[model samples]
Target: MMGLLLSLLSGLIFGAGLAISGMADPARVQAFLDIFGAWDPTLAFVMGGALIPMAIAWKLRKGMKKPLAAGAFDLPGTRQIDKKLALGALFFGVGWGISGLCPGPALADLAIAPGPAAIFIGAMLGGMALHKITVE
Candidate 1:
């Protein structure tokens, strides 16, 4: 119950941030991805802000043998750059560029513009289904 409550609170906070930052709008994200045209760089700052916490996590996970929450490490130690990762990233970029919606922001938009968000999320789930069928 405690973990569930905390998860719900964190999700709410994240959704609120996405909504307030105008990132929940697909048009805004599409504008950000418009590199050759009238590019909006506002989301770049948001991405930069996110990098700080990501860097901290990277450093800490490198040193820590065990995670604080579960009292055991849940991270991989490999720093290997590989082909599968590159292809996955390319696919993710294509999907994002085409739809202008990432997973979290899509969830936030679901309450407002249901159509695009719903289609994006449904396709995401279908992709997940395909992944599970192939991989595991």
Candidate 2:
């Protein structure tokens, strides 16, 4: 129950940050990506803002035995740069560049911009399903 509450709270905070930072707007994100056009650099500040606390958390986690809400830290096991990882990242970047809606922002946009967000989310889920079906 406590873990679930913490998860919900964390998600709410993240979604709120996305919404407040104008990241929930596809146009804003697209503008940020549009170099040589009417480009916006506000997202860089958002990224930097998010990175500070995350970096602190990571640094703090190194000295901790367990998380406050969980029994143990479930960190990623691998640090390798392999083909599958690279290809997945490339696909994600392409999708984001084209749609201007990555998962977090897309999900945050659902309440405000339902139509396009739904379409993007549906397509994203379809891609995930396709990957599950095709990949090992």
Against the reference, the lDDT scores of all candidates come to 0.88, 0.90
What C-alpha lDDT, on a 0 to 100 scale, does residue 35 get in candidate 1? 87
Q: How would you encode candidate 1's per-residue C-alpha lDDT over 1-136 as one tens digit per residue? A: 6656777888999999999989888888899999899899999999999999999998988898775545576555787879977988899999998899989999999987999899999999999899899999
The stretch of ten residues in a row with the least summed lDDT in candidate 1 is 67-76
For every model in order, what is the number of clashing pairs? 0, 0
Off by over 4 Å in 2: none
lDDT of 2 by residue, 24-119 (tens): 888888888998899999888888887999999999998999999999999779999999899999999888988999998888888788899999
Specify the highest-lDDT model's number.
Answer: 2
What is residue 10's positional error in candidate 1, in angstroms?
1.2
Estimate TM-scores for all models.
Answer: 0.87, 0.92
Cα displacement (angstroms), candidate 1, residue 57, comes to 4.0
Distance from true location, Cα of 120 in model 1, Å: 0.5
Task: Name the lDDT value of residue 121 in candidate 1.
Answer: 99
